[model samples]
Target: MAQRLQSISAVTVSGALVIVLLLTLTFGTLGAVAFRADSLSGLSTRDWAAVRFTVVQAFLSALLSVILAIPVARALARRQFWGRSVLVTLLGAPFILPVIVAVLGLLSVFGRNGLLSQALGFAGLEPVSIYGAHGVVLAHVFFNLPLATRLILQGWLAIPAERFRLAASLGFGARDILRHLEWPMLLAVVPGAFMVIFLICTTSFAVALALGGGPKATTIELAIYQAFRFDFNLSKAALLALAQFGLCAIAAVISLWVSIPAGQGAGLDRVVARRDGSRILDFTVLLLVTLFLITPLGVIAVKGLGSVLSLPASTYGAAGRSVCVALASALLTIALTLPLALLAQRVSKLIEGVGYLSIAASPLVIGTGLFILVYRWADPVVLALPITILVNAAMSLPFALRAIAPALAEVERDYGRLSDSLGLTGMARMRLVILPRLRRPLGFGAGLAAALSMGDLGVIALFADPDSATLPLAMYRLMTAYRMDDAHGAALLLLSLSLLLFWVFDRGGRVNADI
Candidate 1:
């Protein structure tokens, strides 16, 4: 009876936290709406244009990312070589890589003075510019392609070796193998990957701000930033935020509907000898994909080596602020995620839908709303850092839940009854039976939250006073000032800090951890 009461208490606490998050979002959005009730007149022509451009770019980015990922994922799945595991791990890098860093790296490879343009100029050919709509698409593809590839690769890996063996026993050639086995898997996986990437691209702020050369290429997110930061038009910002919220929510709903879990069940590690895919073709694909992903990162490292130590003192100050925010966010996220995950083991469907609300939310909307709420009571700038930390933690909850929930459920499934029978309730049970087994996922989730928070530039950009800029925002300011070298240095610092935080947390979790 005591153990049951403890379980109920856990569930109740988790449910209350979820309710608080939902209420915060709901009331904040509604409050912004009320504040702008008169200004909620129809969207201007420019607003419509922003909406149109946003959807089109997200669609194009998602389509191109998934289509390109297919070949790369297939090649990786079939080819066995030295450093395969390393390559797979490298794919996760883009997830935590700061957007500004990626944009700079990409510019080094595709900008007017870049290698491609220089080679073309040497050959008496016209230099190509990487700006406008195509530039935005290129950046999105760079970031999302690896994500799509990993998702598709997970699908491929999930296919049982026994199935492959059966197909081979029937003398299935390359064409037959693709037609019979691979096509079906793609059918199940691609749409979900496309939708997920599309939703992500919809909320893109940093990439669009940098690569989108002008109004012609501007995304809705950039428009929101302009409304809030440059124009100081809270009404217009709120309106745009609502529009963005609607767009992402619709996409999120569709994604939830069409999404088949890609990497769910385990597969045998045995390699199935397959009579498919040309060795030459696989090698070419692998080489191009590797170059595409690796060159920009290499440029960042090489270019920053000369100037990384010469960054302005303000850069280090911003880095310190960012570290504090990231650490706080990570700790908060883990605290929120643990109970939510534990509760999710009992009410998965409901908890999952609620968790996705964060993804559908616009950071600008939340910031605008909070600014309205707190400005009435106190100066918004005073609460800026705390609000940023809370918002970052909220933004990270879904991912943290994804990392931790499954492990919690698995533990409960495997060991719940044993603990209950032993009368192990409350803190003792958690420390003795639950936490020791949860180290790996907890560590990974915390690391991910920290890295993401460290690099995030959304809410903070709206709230930060001059003295309160975070690292990413500091880098943006340097770029805007045309201090390219300083910007590179800041990027290097931000990148190193983000990766180091992730490595330390992840390694900590894995030490003496059970698989």
Candidate 2:
């Protein structure tokens, strides 16, 4: 028995070390660099303006997304029609869409000569420019609306059918329903949804970089990049990183606090015997929301079909590099998650929170810390790809753990005693028992990680030179150069890769999966 336990000591210790090292780098290194500059005392008017803009835009974006989502989500929740599932799936598309690609799609529909502007121009109105604060908020809403909708939708779906049936029995009308059941759910759900979207917006860089021009609209994430890349002002960059991290930390606390679960009693999954309010109103909301979300992507697809195949060699090169990064990041996600999950089973589960640290520290903030550390030893430019790969993996770790850990716990619960009784342990148990059962979740998680890495435009933008550029960065370069066609082509290619990798990895080898 002693020998059996000792067999995995080294591996266990290694997992602990990994968590320690992650914590040290995440906060410890940043803490040291943050105080190195008088940046805390030296924040300029522009710096404070960036901070203000960051919070204000994020607040507005979150508020608007939630407000718009309420009607849309309620409609979807009560009405189950043909193609409803497909529509729900489409809502998730923006999340995985590359930031730069989504920005292009938004531009296609809302740019100065875009569909909206063109329509207005044909009606003898002015062409509206999407290159400022309005554009930034518009882009943030486009990306986050679905997220807010889905979050609220889940809240709606959580209401047991029995409750609605009882409400109908009591002769509750729309307003009555709003007061009794709907308001309670909204009270419980909306704060968390708003905070999540706000956190995401506060950390937005690509949207701001592409649309938010001028000092008045700069976000802390973008300011970090400008200070780091253009000004070569490490002090300013570190300070901005500090600010962004603090912002995220406060938002995280609020999300956790405000996200208290109101008890919705369990049900028999029966259908509700209640009327969905105003079919015309609900249908109109669905139609407009669908078109609003889908039209821009459709424009990108139609435009890119003409050029995706004949894109420049550099486009394909960047695509290949992104693929490599995605694959590497996925692999690393697996490596990190499996060990940490096992350590949790054997030790304490609180350690798993280390995986989530990446979320609170935006990729740029992490890159900023890494830069501070690397600058002391080696040129960060030389280490760009590696750093991007590492950050992508770390960022994906939380999602991977969410996928893998639960399955692992269940597997261990069902099989742990048997494996031990049979003298199965370590690699043998993993190969013969654990890995087989985890195939589905592993596939899904790795696919998600790969998809995210493929579409990522955050950390790489902070670190990469032309030679080290990922596809998203390359597309941004094209957009900046006014090569719209090439940019769309690259966007198409990137969009394809992101979706394909996710589909392949998610569906890969799940044929008769053990679970």
How large is the C-alpha RMSD of every model relative to the true structure?
A: 2.3, 1.5
Model 2 global lDDT (CA atoms, 0 to 1)? 0.88
lDDT of 2 at 223: 88
Q: How many steric clashes does model 2 contain?
A: 0
Error of 1 at 96 (Å): 1.0
Residue range 320-419, candidate 1, lDDT tens digits: 9999999999998888888777666766647755665788886767787887677778987788889888888888888988888878888989999999
Tell me the lDDT of model 2 at 302: 93
lDDT of 2 by residue, 1-515 (tens): 76477647845886787797678667865786586556487778899999999999999999999999999999998887899999999999898888898899989998986899999998999988888888999999999999999999999999999988888888888899888899999999999999999999998889999999688889898888898889988898888888898999999889878996857879888877457489889989999999998998999999999989989898899999999999999998888888888888777788777877877878888888887787878988889888888888888888889998899899989999998999987778889999999999899889989999998888888778898899999999999999999989999999999999999988984867956
Lowest summed lDDT across 10 adjacent residues in model 2 is found at 2-11
Candidate 1 backbone collisions, by pair: none
What is residue 245's positional error in candidate 2, in angstroms?
Answer: 0.8
